[model samples]
Each structure stands twice: as C-alpha cells, then as structure tokens.
Target: MATITSASLPRPATRGEAKLFAEFRAFWRAFVAKAFNPYRPELHYMRGPGPAWRAKHVGLSPAVQSMLAEIRTGKARRSSPSA
Candidate 1:
C-alpha cells in the first residue's frame, strides 16, 4: 500500500469553495497520472490504472483509503473490479 505523507495531502478547502479545490484536485490528478503512467505508446490508453491503483492504494480520505485497500488486497469483502 502507498503511504500518505503530509506532502501528498491536499490543502483543505472550505465547504462550498469549489473553484480552487476543483482546480487543485484536477492538477493533482494530472500530476499523479503523469508520474505513474509509463511514457510510452502501449501504456497511453491505460491512464485509468493509475487512478484505480490510487483509489485502491492511496485514497483521497481515510475511509476511502480503507475501502480501496480492501479492494486492492482482496480481503474478505473484496469489491468488484472497476472498469
């Protein structure tokens, strides 16, 4: 499982402030994609595996993290594979 360092945590946004948060999340996701995706033709179409792996390993929140870990590690309550 991936570790959750403070540096990886996104800055907290207010309850209704969507603009900055949305942009930040988008930027973060893009950054993650570029970082994890292999810079080649074959892996080009497999962008989602990074996000899926993230959702399964380094989730956005603790609850999500736990759920993702369960799915990734295939515990008793394994979640169905996501497309």
Candidate 2:
C-alpha cells in the first residue's frame, strides 16, 4: 500500500474563527427576526453594542490612542497615511 500526501492540504479553521462565525450566524438570525418583527425585544438587542462594550476595550496602545484622539477631533479619517 502506498500513502499519498498533497502539497496543499487545506488548513483547518481555528477555534477562534469558528466561534466568530457562530456569533455572526446568530447575529444574522437576530437581524432577520427583527426585520419581520420590529417590536421584538431581540430586535433592540441586535441593534448593537451598549456602553459596556465601549468601556471594555478602553485601554489601548499609545499609537492607537493617539489615532483615536485624532479621529475624535476630526484630525484624521482612520489609518495613518505613513503607516
């Protein structure tokens, strides 16, 4: 018996990517439900982030902090040109 191996065996999806995909699917389902039932509580939930989400990642690298400040004050439109 001979064993064969291909040069390009597809890489398995990482756990993080799979989890993200699951979250995205849930969001999609919620969105569709909201579309058909505008007054549903889940509709409001799916609308997006609350204060907690914003507050969780408040700390950032100095470079990122500066860039965020620039954006907040309208000095930049994301992604520094030099970078």
Which candidate comes out best when scored by lDDT? 2
RMSD of every prediction? 31.6, 27.3
Give lDDT tens digits, candidate 1, residues 12-35. 778668887888899999999998
lDDT of each: 0.77, 0.81
What's model 2's lDDT at 19? 97
**Cα deviation in Å at residue 6, candidate 1?**
31
Query: How many residue pairs in model 2 have overlapping backbones?
Result: 0
* lDDT by residue for model 2 (1-83), tens: 99998798889889999999999999999998878875756555776677798789566789999988877867554545755
Write down the RMSD of candidate 1 (Cα, Å): 31.6
